[model samples]
Target: MAERSTPGSTPGRLLAPPSLPDGAELVMRVMPMPADVNANGDVFGGWIMAQVDVAGAVLPARIARGRIVTVAVNQFTFKQPVSIGDLLSFYARITRLGRTSITVHVEVHAERDPVNPQLVKVTEANLTYVAIDGLGQPRVLTRQV
Candidate 1:
């Protein structure tokens, strides 16, 4: 399902993926506001990076079955500028699993003009998450059946 750009208004444009390569799933959609923009009038790269971190952590948090913490963000590339009123969608897939950490590959796509519904991959990144305990200590993840 496509999420609306504003909380109460209908989505001006659908942000659904035109196609996913393979083994990837849509995770979440976010709309950036003016507050998130930089002095250049484009959404800040830090904001996009933060969203990617959140998207990368989702599955590992579920699989770890407990508290998790962001351990690392290996690489992030910004391919396009995100503007206000654009719908941003994140897609993620687990790429590697270690005893206590998991790597997630995330792709960010933006709807240039929601009214037109055209989607473009604006950024991509690989993030690693580690399972953590209540005290914020690393813990090994138990494999799920």
Candidate 2:
């Protein structure tokens, strides 16, 4: 689990990737398109960042049981290049819960090569989201305990 995802024993098959985190939740999944690529042809960091923000908010939204707004991206790391056609999976877990904010850590894994099969980690990020009221003002989180 510390290294690459497990592979299938037989040909033309692949085992699923290892658990991203012990209690992480699967929040989102999407495949990149050529339009999302950068000059180098890898997925653009900004586009990935945006998707991460969306993926990171899932838990906070549930905990808050309402609307939330992104307050900050505490950290983001791109471990590997993401290529088009790779099936991307985003897993997230709440690392911290505050009175009005929740911090979530997210990891993105890419499954590539339909025939040969490869699973690689593409990104990981720490993001903070704040529960907000209809007025767009920070509101207290119900699960602050």
Candidate 3:
């Protein structure tokens, strides 16, 4: 399989990606196009971050059963630079549930080189979302019990 190091880093250095964590659900999959690339010919980090936010909100929106807004990005890390044409898969698992908020851990993996077939961990993040009312104010989440 073709291996490429992160942009601006030492060349020929590759780290084996860790196994995907258990209990995470596949939330989304997308491939970046030429328009998503930056001047370096790599996908822009901001674009990936935006996608992560959307993927991280999926479960929270279902649990909130109404409107939800991103409250915080607790953590974000880019393990590898994403290239156009790489198939990106986003997985998310809920890590916390508060009275009006939900925190989710998201992992993004890139499947590249269709002929060679390599899966690389590209990014991971933790984000928090809060349920909101019609007025966009945070509201307490109702218990199912």
Q: Report the C-alpha lDDT of model 3 over 1-145, residue by residue, as the tens digit.
A: 2355655655665534458787788889899999999999999999999999999999998899999999899999999999999988898999999999999999999988854556889999999999999999999988531
Error of 3 at 36 (Å): 0.2
The digit string of per-residue lDDT tens for model 1 on 1-145 reads: 4643644546553345767657888788899998999999999999999889988888888899988888888988999899998888899998899989999999988876544456889999999989888889889899751
How many clashes show up in model 1? Answer: 0
Per-candidate TM-scores read: 0.85, 0.87, 0.85
Per-candidate count of clashing residue pairs (backbone under 3 Å): 0, 0, 0
Model 1: residues >4 Å from true position, as ranges? 3-16
Lowest lDDT 10-residue stretch of candidate 3: 1-10
Q: Model 2: what TM-score?
A: 0.87
* Residue 125 lDDT (model 1): 94
Q: How much lDDT does candidate 1 score?
A: 0.83
lDDT of every predicted structure (CA atoms): 0.83, 0.85, 0.87
For lDDT, the strongest prediction is 3
lDDT of 1 at 86: 83
lDDT of 2 by residue, 1-145 (tens): 1133335455434356666787887789898999999999999999999999989988888789999999999999999999888888899999988889999999999888865567788899999999999999999887753
